[model samples]
Target: MQNIIEVKDLRKEFKSHSSRSGLKGAFRDLLTRNYKVIPAVNDISFTVTKGEMVGYIGENGAGKSTSIKMLTGILNPTSGSVIVNGMNPHKEREKFVRTIGVVFGQRSNLWWDIAVQESFRLLKKVYNVPDDVYKDHMNHVIESLDIAPLLDKPVRKLSLGQRMRCELAAALLHNPPLLFLDEPTIGLDVLVKLKIREFLKEMNKKYETTVLLTTHDLTDIEALCERVVMLDEGKIIYDGKLAKLRSNWGEGKQIEFQFADIHVKKETLDPLLADLDAAWTPGNQKNVWIANVRNDEHIISEVIGRVVASNKITDLKVHEISIEDIIRNIYEEGIING
Candidate 1:
């Protein structure tokens, strides 16, 4: 496979000012300024080859967006290098951007007052796409995204889901070789997310477009990516195949504990399985809690025994631990730092 992205020792830092409380501190600030250098991306490095969909995920304030900004030539790193499609992202920005498509979830690239079709036309001209090529790709994307009805509507008039479909169409107008998606399905409904995921899969298959996706939603990664790069506090903690991560988690069983009290604290349940290879997190419902416990008869019984003794358990259900559960555990516990 050809390498589309090459990042080596990529680091980005920002200067933060220190503030103080009272009049004494205000007077201190008049004479000398205090600055703290914070590293947003601290000596992290990774690469993506052509046609690969890789997920870059982490918690909030984990530098996922910061890294994306640097990769897209929007921000210059304090040190190190970034090369995309054989061009420096920062130094060769004008040329480099031509080979890549970017879709930020909260931001729109389309002109708000113009019709979606007009934005597509403008993009075609901006990227210098041939007329025939533009028409063919435009028809293909509009049909694939089911956005034909939205073509005549202004961008601001479209709903979040409708605008998202248009946003996707806009990004692929020029059919760039590489795509960067940041939370592409962030605030959309489940059906819309499914539609976007299917479209991404088809586009990847149809065009062999390399994608670097950064999302908090693990389901997106589970559905679209075979490999993932996990980050924490601007550092690369785990980088490898998602299947391998699940395999190493062993045969664990997920037990959902439903209680009468919605105000139950996790700290009360964690200590029961402290000595075992287990993790607990809040379930979809407030009164329900889920735990991934090792698949040992004795271990499972010990956990249930301890918990049942303390609380009035309304219901208990056991099932196979899912990939989402393992990834969520990593989010809370940092279990796969190696």
Candidate 2:
């Protein structure tokens, strides 16, 4: 497996100035300059192999977007190197961009007044894609995304979901082998989101396109990526399989057990529950009690035994921590440091 993207000690810094408060401060600012250097990406390094989909995730102000910008040649790194498709992205920006596609959910790359199909045609010219290749990609994407009916409508006239579908097709018109998707499904309905996810999955499988996806929606990551790179405060904290990240950092499973006796009292059950170390909550049902327990097998068994010994268990459920909760915990704990 060849690495489609390679980043080594990548760093990006920005200089921002503090605005003068009042007339006196403004006069002082005019006399001199005040600036502060902020490191948006702090010596991060990672790799993505061909045919691999990686989820890049972090809280706001984290360096996920900055890293993607450097990798896609939109921004030059203040230090270190970024290689995509065997080319230095910042050095050979035009050539590097030719080998990859990018879609930022907050912005549109499509021509506002032009029809969706025309925007794709213009992109084909921009990328110098051959007629046959362009046609094939267009046909595949249009059909896969079910955007044929939207082709004739002006980009600005389409709804967000409709326009997003067009934006995705436009990005792929050149059939770039690598894709940078930053919140691609953001602000879309559940149905539309599912459609986009399905199309992306099919495209990756059929074309072997390597994708780097950054999204706040954990469901998208769970569906699209097996590997994830977690960042915090401009540093990579975890870079490995999503499952392992969850298994390692994941808090634990929550167990909910329902008892046969609907009128069971907490006072009576206090003796049986006193031995377990788990937190207890009264379930919505009168006889049910929920226990938040660790992921460990022995601890879970002990908790379950205590619950069962107190009363006849009718229904039970064990739920692992969701990816959303996992990421939230990571942020709240300040687990990643530069």
Candidate 3:
């Protein structure tokens, strides 16, 4: 497979003026000149092949937006290189952008005063899409996104979810080969998100479009992407299969047991709990105990056995670490390697 997006040693920087905290310092600083260089994207390199959906994820101020801007030719990198579809995004701006579509979650790409279908028609004219091709893409987007009813309504009058559906449709009207979605599912209801995810999956499957999705929502990553590229402090940290990341950095399992007796003696359970090396905590109920067991299956089994033997377990439930928790651990621990 050919790579559609290639970035090598990509870097971006900005100059900041030094500012003083207090009134006196602020007045004195006006007489002097000083500047600091901040690196927003530091030596990051990765590639996305045709027809692959990859997640580019990070916490706030982690250079995710900066990298995306550079990739989309909105902002030029301070140094190094970026190439998409055999052309330099910044140098060949007009031609490069035609091959890709971008959607920012908080921004509106549609004309607010126009009806939804009018917006689509405007995009059709802007992209010079043929009559047959426009109809084909429009039909697919409307059916896939369930936005047929929204077409006649004004964009400003639509709800957030409805507007989002229309925005996605407008972006795809050109039938671009590459899609760049930044937080597309942010602030959407679960049902709307599910619809968008399904549409994206079908778009990739049926049209062979390459996608680069940037989102804080791990559920999006888990459901839509096979590979992920993680950035931290303006540098590339981990880029690999999403499953491998879960297996390597996944959090410990959780086991909750409900006992018959509410007044379980602390001392009586100390010795039994001491053998399990797990982080135990009190559950919501008085007769409940929750333990964060190790990732190892054997240890989890042994810990459960010990709990069951000591107390009459009325109910039990076990769960693996959630993707959100795993991502939290990654940000907290600053784990750079998988």
Candidate 4:
């Protein structure tokens, strides 16, 4: 596969000025100003191949937005290199933007006063899409996003969820091969998120669109991306398959056991799993027990066997450590390996 996005030691810096409160200090500051250089995106490098759905994630103020701006040609980097689709995003912004679509969760790309379909039509003309191509893309987007009814409604008149659906449709209407989504599913309900995720999956498969998704929602990353690039303090920390990340940092399993509507106290099960070293807790409902079991100390089967033999377990569930947990651990431990 060809590399659609390539970044190497790409760095971006911003200057800040400090002002004093007092009159003398303020007057002195005006004559000799103080400025500081802050690196929003400092020496980060990664690549996205054609059709690859990769997650670029980090905490707030971790440079995710700054990097996206640079990639989208909204901001120029202070140093190093960024070649996206065989063009410098900053220098060749006019041509580069036509090949990609961007969606920012907090911002509106569509005209607020215009109807949803009008916004899309404007986009088609802006991108100079052909009549047949625009019709096909619009049909697919409206169906996939379930926004056929929203087409006649003005953007300001729609609800957040409805507007989001329209936002996604407008971005994909031109069928840009590269998509940059910054928290596309933010503040959306579960059903709405599911719809968006499914639409993105189908779009990627049908069009081979390379996606670079950045979001604080780990579930979005888990649902759509097999590979993830974790960012922290403006640098790449972990870039690998999600499975491998789990193998390395997915230390424990969460096992839940539900009793058969009987009086099952914690003391009864303590004897059974005394040696399992499980940090057990009671579920919200009664007759249910949840525990985190270590893989290094005991085999999962043995642990389950110990509990099942003594207690009547009507239902049991075992889940591997989730990406959310793994990410929390990585950030806390400050694991830096790319």
TM-score for each model: 0.87, 0.85, 0.90, 0.86
Local accuracy of candidate 2 as per-residue lDDT tens digits, 1-338 = 89999899999999999877889999999988789999999999888999999999988999888888888888999999888899998789877888888889999989999888888888889999999888877898999899999999999899999998988988888888998899999999999999999999998999999999999999999999999998988999888898887877776887888888888777776676576666776878887877776778998998888778767888999988678877877778777531
Model 2 reaches what TM-score against the true structure?
Answer: 0.85
Pick out the ten consecutive residues of candidate 4 with the lowest summed lDDT.
291-300
Please provide, for model 4 over 67-91, each residue's C-alpha lDDT reduced to its tens digit, 9 standing for 90 to 100.
9999999999999899999999999
- Per-candidate count of clashing residue pairs (backbone under 3 Å): 0, 0, 0, 0
Write down the lDDT that model 1 would get: 0.89
Per-residue CA lDDT of model 1 for 88-181, tens digit only, reads: 8889988988999999999998999999999988888899999999889889889989999998999999999999989998999899999999
- Write the residue-wise lDDT of candidate 3 on 1-338 in tens digits: 89999999999999999887789878878898568999999999899999999999988999999999999999998999999988899999999988998899999889999899988888888889999988877897899899999999999999999988888888888989999999998899999999999999999999899999999998999999999999999988889998888888664788888889998755666677686767666778888877777778889888888889878989999988777777778888888867
Shift in Å, residue 311, candidate 2: 12
Q: All models: lDDT?
A: 0.89, 0.87, 0.89, 0.89
The local lDDT score (0 to 100) that residue 132 gets in candidate 3 is 96
Q: Say what the RMSD of model 1 is.
A: 3.5
Prediction 1 TM-score vs. true: 0.87
Model 1 spans with C-alpha error above 4 angstroms: 257-291, 296-316, 322-324, 331-337
